[model samples]
Target: MENEVLQDVMLTATILIPILAALVEVLKKAVKLPKNLLPLISVVLGLILGVVSYKFTDLDLVLRLWAGAFAGLAGTGLFEALKTRIGTTK
Candidate 1:
Protein backbone atom coordinates (compact mmCIF):
# COMPACT_ATOMS: atom_id res chain seq x y z
CA MET A 1 0.00 0.00 0.00
CA GLU A 2 2.89 2.28 0.79
CA ASN A 3 4.36 1.59 -2.59
CA GLU A 4 1.04 2.34 -4.23
CA VAL A 5 0.82 5.61 -2.38
CA LEU A 6 4.35 6.62 -3.24
CA GLN A 7 3.87 5.61 -6.83
CA ASP A 8 0.76 7.71 -7.00
CA VAL A 9 2.58 10.60 -5.43
CA MET A 10 5.45 10.42 -7.89
CA LEU A 11 3.15 9.96 -10.85
CA THR A 12 1.14 12.98 -9.81
CA ALA A 13 4.21 15.07 -9.14
CA THR A 14 5.73 14.25 -12.48
CA ILE A 15 2.68 15.30 -14.46
CA LEU A 16 1.90 18.47 -12.56
CA ILE A 17 5.47 19.71 -12.53
CA PRO A 18 5.56 20.30 -16.25
CA ILE A 19 2.16 21.95 -16.38
CA LEU A 20 3.04 24.18 -13.43
CA ALA A 21 6.32 25.20 -15.01
CA ALA A 22 4.66 26.06 -18.28
CA LEU A 23 1.85 27.98 -16.62
CA VAL A 24 4.38 29.90 -14.58
CA GLU A 25 6.26 30.90 -17.67
CA VAL A 26 3.14 32.09 -19.40
CA LEU A 27 2.07 34.08 -16.35
CA LYS A 28 5.51 35.62 -16.11
CA LYS A 29 5.31 36.81 -19.68
CA ALA A 30 1.66 37.80 -19.48
CA VAL A 31 1.86 39.85 -16.28
CA LYS A 32 5.36 41.21 -16.64
CA LEU A 33 6.07 40.36 -13.00
CA PRO A 34 9.67 40.35 -11.93
CA LYS A 35 11.53 37.24 -13.05
CA ASN A 36 12.66 36.76 -9.46
CA LEU A 37 9.04 36.48 -8.37
CA LEU A 38 8.22 33.61 -10.69
CA PRO A 39 8.89 30.91 -8.12
CA LEU A 40 6.64 32.48 -5.53
CA ILE A 41 3.94 33.20 -8.02
CA SER A 42 4.25 29.76 -9.47
CA VAL A 43 3.78 28.27 -6.03
CA VAL A 44 0.64 30.28 -5.48
CA LEU A 45 -0.67 29.64 -8.92
CA GLY A 46 0.07 25.96 -8.65
CA LEU A 47 -1.96 25.59 -5.46
CA ILE A 48 -4.84 27.57 -6.83
CA LEU A 49 -4.79 25.61 -10.01
CA GLY A 50 -4.64 22.41 -8.02
CA VAL A 51 -7.54 23.43 -5.84
CA VAL A 52 -9.59 24.23 -8.87
CA SER A 53 -8.78 20.87 -10.31
CA TYR A 54 -9.59 19.13 -7.04
CA LYS A 55 -13.01 20.70 -6.95
CA PHE A 56 -13.83 19.59 -10.45
CA THR A 57 -12.79 15.96 -10.87
CA ASP A 58 -14.78 12.78 -10.25
CA LEU A 59 -13.37 9.91 -12.28
CA ASP A 60 -11.62 6.79 -10.95
CA LEU A 61 -7.88 6.62 -11.52
CA VAL A 62 -8.07 10.04 -13.07
CA LEU A 63 -9.63 11.41 -9.93
CA ARG A 64 -7.07 9.72 -7.77
CA LEU A 65 -4.29 11.01 -9.94
CA TRP A 66 -5.70 14.51 -9.85
CA ALA A 67 -6.04 14.38 -6.09
CA GLY A 68 -2.49 13.24 -5.66
CA ALA A 69 -1.18 15.75 -8.14
CA PHE A 70 -2.95 18.65 -6.47
CA ALA A 71 -1.81 17.48 -3.08
CA GLY A 72 1.78 17.43 -4.24
CA LEU A 73 1.48 20.74 -5.99
CA ALA A 74 -0.04 22.42 -2.98
CA GLY A 75 2.48 20.81 -0.67
CA THR A 76 5.25 22.12 -2.85
CA GLY A 77 3.68 25.57 -2.76
CA LEU A 78 3.38 25.43 0.99
CA PHE A 79 7.01 24.45 1.25
CA GLU A 80 8.07 27.36 -0.90
CA ALA A 81 5.93 29.76 1.08
CA LEU A 82 7.54 28.61 4.30
CA LYS A 83 10.97 28.70 2.76
CA THR A 84 10.45 32.25 1.59
CA ARG A 85 9.25 33.37 4.98
CA ILE A 86 12.17 31.68 6.69
CA GLY A 87 14.69 33.23 4.33
CA THR A 88 13.30 36.70 4.90
CA THR A 89 13.12 36.51 8.66
CA LYS A 90 14.89 39.35 10.44
Candidate 2:
Protein backbone atom coordinates (compact mmCIF):
# COMPACT_ATOMS: atom_id res chain seq x y z
CA MET A 1 0.00 0.00 0.00
CA GLU A 2 2.73 2.44 0.96
CA ASN A 3 4.72 1.47 -2.06
CA GLU A 4 1.73 2.06 -4.33
CA VAL A 5 1.18 5.46 -2.81
CA LEU A 6 4.82 6.35 -3.28
CA GLN A 7 4.72 5.26 -6.89
CA ASP A 8 1.51 7.22 -7.42
CA VAL A 9 3.13 10.32 -6.00
CA MET A 10 6.01 9.92 -8.39
CA LEU A 11 3.58 9.35 -11.25
CA THR A 12 1.50 12.41 -10.47
CA ALA A 13 4.57 14.59 -10.18
CA THR A 14 5.97 13.32 -13.44
CA ILE A 15 2.68 13.92 -15.27
CA LEU A 16 1.82 17.27 -13.72
CA ILE A 17 5.09 19.09 -14.21
CA PRO A 18 5.24 18.80 -17.96
CA ILE A 19 1.52 19.46 -18.39
CA LEU A 20 1.74 22.58 -16.29
CA ALA A 21 4.85 23.64 -18.12
CA ALA A 22 3.18 23.17 -21.44
CA LEU A 23 0.16 25.10 -20.30
CA VAL A 24 2.41 27.92 -19.21
CA GLU A 25 4.17 27.95 -22.53
CA VAL A 26 0.91 27.90 -24.43
CA LEU A 27 -0.41 30.83 -22.51
CA LYS A 28 2.85 32.70 -22.79
CA LYS A 29 3.13 32.13 -26.52
CA ALA A 30 -0.57 32.59 -27.13
CA VAL A 31 -0.83 29.24 -28.80
CA LYS A 32 -4.28 28.41 -30.09
CA LEU A 33 -5.71 24.99 -29.28
CA PRO A 34 -9.05 23.31 -29.62
CA LYS A 35 -11.57 23.20 -26.82
CA ASN A 36 -12.22 19.95 -24.87
CA LEU A 37 -8.63 18.98 -25.50
CA LEU A 38 -7.57 18.96 -21.89
CA PRO A 39 -8.49 15.32 -21.37
CA LEU A 40 -6.50 14.05 -24.33
CA ILE A 41 -3.61 16.24 -23.29
CA SER A 42 -3.70 14.68 -19.90
CA VAL A 43 -3.52 11.18 -21.34
CA VAL A 44 -0.56 11.90 -23.57
CA LEU A 45 1.18 13.64 -20.75
CA GLY A 46 0.45 10.65 -18.55
CA LEU A 47 2.04 8.32 -21.07
CA ILE A 48 5.18 10.38 -21.32
CA LEU A 49 5.37 10.65 -17.58
CA GLY A 50 4.91 6.94 -17.13
CA VAL A 51 7.73 6.14 -19.51
CA VAL A 52 10.15 8.55 -17.90
CA SER A 53 9.28 7.63 -14.35
CA TYR A 54 9.64 3.95 -15.08
CA LYS A 55 13.01 4.63 -16.64
CA PHE A 56 14.37 6.66 -13.74
CA THR A 57 12.50 5.30 -10.72
CA ASP A 58 12.36 2.05 -8.84
CA LEU A 59 8.83 1.05 -9.70
CA ASP A 60 7.14 -1.77 -11.54
CA LEU A 61 7.22 -0.35 -15.04
CA VAL A 62 4.18 -2.02 -16.56
CA LEU A 63 2.04 -1.68 -13.49
CA ARG A 64 3.03 1.89 -12.89
CA LEU A 65 2.43 2.83 -16.49
CA TRP A 66 -1.03 1.29 -16.51
CA ALA A 67 -1.80 2.88 -13.19
CA GLY A 68 -0.78 6.27 -14.49
CA ALA A 69 -3.00 5.94 -17.52
CA PHE A 70 -5.94 4.78 -15.48
CA ALA A 71 -5.46 7.47 -12.90
CA GLY A 72 -5.23 10.19 -15.50
CA LEU A 73 -8.40 9.26 -17.31
CA ALA A 74 -10.45 8.49 -14.22
CA GLY A 75 -9.23 11.58 -12.43
CA THR A 76 -10.03 13.92 -15.27
CA GLY A 77 -13.43 12.38 -15.77
CA LEU A 78 -14.31 12.53 -12.12
CA PHE A 79 -13.15 16.09 -11.55
CA GLU A 80 -14.65 17.48 -14.70
CA ALA A 81 -17.94 15.83 -13.99
CA LEU A 82 -17.94 17.04 -10.43
CA LYS A 83 -17.16 20.56 -11.46
CA THR A 84 -19.90 20.63 -14.02
CA ARG A 85 -22.42 19.10 -11.68
CA ILE A 86 -21.47 21.48 -8.92
CA GLY A 87 -21.70 24.41 -11.35
CA THR A 88 -18.21 25.59 -10.56
CA THR A 89 -16.23 27.07 -13.40
CA LYS A 90 -13.07 28.45 -12.03
Candidate 3:
Protein backbone atom coordinates (compact mmCIF):
# COMPACT_ATOMS: atom_id res chain seq x y z
CA MET A 1 0.00 0.00 0.00
CA GLU A 2 2.74 2.37 0.94
CA ASN A 3 4.74 1.49 -2.13
CA GLU A 4 1.73 2.10 -4.36
CA VAL A 5 1.20 5.48 -2.80
CA LEU A 6 4.82 6.38 -3.27
CA GLN A 7 4.69 5.31 -6.88
CA ASP A 8 1.60 7.44 -7.43
CA VAL A 9 3.33 10.46 -5.98
CA MET A 10 6.36 9.85 -8.15
CA LEU A 11 4.18 9.56 -11.24
CA THR A 12 2.36 12.76 -10.39
CA ALA A 13 5.67 14.53 -9.98
CA THR A 14 6.86 13.09 -13.27
CA ILE A 15 3.93 14.75 -15.05
CA LEU A 16 3.67 17.98 -13.05
CA ILE A 17 7.32 19.02 -13.00
CA PRO A 18 7.54 19.56 -16.73
CA ILE A 19 4.17 21.29 -16.82
CA LEU A 20 5.26 23.64 -14.10
CA ALA A 21 8.50 24.31 -15.93
CA ALA A 22 6.57 25.14 -19.09
CA LEU A 23 4.30 27.48 -17.16
CA VAL A 24 7.28 29.31 -15.77
CA GLU A 25 8.90 29.56 -19.17
CA VAL A 26 5.75 31.04 -20.67
CA LEU A 27 5.03 33.46 -17.84
CA LYS A 28 8.52 34.85 -17.45
CA LYS A 29 9.71 37.12 -20.23
CA ALA A 30 13.06 38.04 -18.71
CA VAL A 31 14.66 35.07 -20.43
CA LYS A 32 14.33 35.23 -24.17
CA LEU A 33 13.87 31.61 -25.15
CA PRO A 34 13.41 30.68 -28.78
CA LYS A 35 9.96 29.25 -29.39
CA ASN A 36 11.36 26.28 -31.24
CA LEU A 37 13.22 25.13 -28.13
CA LEU A 38 10.09 24.60 -26.05
CA PRO A 39 9.67 20.96 -26.98
CA LEU A 40 13.31 20.23 -26.35
CA ILE A 41 13.11 21.97 -23.04
CA SER A 42 10.01 20.00 -22.14
CA VAL A 43 11.68 16.72 -23.00
CA VAL A 44 14.78 17.52 -21.03
CA LEU A 45 12.79 18.65 -18.03
CA GLY A 46 10.67 15.52 -18.30
CA LEU A 47 13.75 13.34 -18.36
CA ILE A 48 15.13 15.05 -15.30
CA LEU A 49 11.79 14.81 -13.53
CA GLY A 50 11.50 11.11 -14.35
CA VAL A 51 14.99 10.32 -13.13
CA VAL A 52 14.64 12.29 -9.95
CA SER A 53 11.21 10.92 -9.17
CA TYR A 54 12.02 7.27 -9.83
CA LYS A 55 15.73 6.87 -9.24
CA PHE A 56 15.26 4.91 -6.05
CA THR A 57 12.59 2.69 -7.57
CA ASP A 58 13.11 -0.74 -9.11
CA LEU A 59 11.15 0.04 -12.26
CA ASP A 60 12.40 -1.07 -15.65
CA LEU A 61 14.32 1.28 -17.90
CA VAL A 62 11.65 1.21 -20.59
CA LEU A 63 8.98 2.15 -18.11
CA ARG A 64 11.01 5.09 -16.93
CA LEU A 65 11.55 6.25 -20.48
CA TRP A 66 7.84 5.95 -21.25
CA ALA A 67 6.99 7.97 -18.17
CA GLY A 68 9.38 10.66 -19.26
CA ALA A 69 7.89 10.76 -22.74
CA PHE A 70 4.41 10.99 -21.32
CA ALA A 71 5.53 13.80 -19.09
CA GLY A 72 6.93 15.67 -22.07
CA LEU A 73 3.68 15.27 -23.99
CA ALA A 74 1.62 16.36 -21.02
CA GLY A 75 3.76 19.43 -20.59
CA THR A 76 3.44 20.37 -24.22
CA GLY A 77 -0.32 19.95 -24.13
CA LEU A 78 -0.68 21.96 -20.96
CA PHE A 79 1.55 24.72 -22.28
CA GLU A 80 -0.45 25.03 -25.48
CA ALA A 81 -3.75 25.03 -23.63
CA LEU A 82 -2.62 27.68 -21.22
CA LYS A 83 -1.13 29.76 -23.99
CA THR A 84 -4.38 29.71 -25.95
CA ARG A 85 -6.56 30.44 -22.95
CA ILE A 86 -4.34 33.13 -21.49
CA GLY A 87 -3.59 34.68 -24.88
CA THR A 88 0.15 35.03 -25.11
CA THR A 89 0.03 38.39 -26.87
CA LYS A 90 2.45 39.83 -24.38
Writing each residue's lDDT as its tens digit, candidate 2 over 2-90 gives 88777665666555554544543364357565647766765665556666666656667765666556555654565555444355445
Query: If scored against the real structure, what TM-score would every candidate get?
Result: 0.53, 0.46, 0.58
Q: Rank the candidates by lDDT, best first.
A: 3, 2, 1
Off by over 4 Å in 2: 1-30, 74-90
Q: Give candidate 1's TM-score.
A: 0.53
Candidate 3, residue 28: how far the Cα is off, in Å: 5.7
Compose the digit string of candidate 3's lDDT tens values, residues 8-87.
54676565655656554764465778777777777776766666656555655555655665677677767676665455
Worst 10 residues of 2 by lDDT: 19-28
Give the top-scoring candidate (lDDT).
3
In TM-score terms, candidate 2 sits at: 0.46
Which model is ahead, 2 or 3, in terms of TM-score?
3
How far residue 21's Cα lies from its native spot in candidate 1, in Å, is 1.4
For residues 1-90, write the lDDT of model 1, one tens digit per residue.
768765654565555666776676566667878756666666566555555554344334554555445654554465445554545556
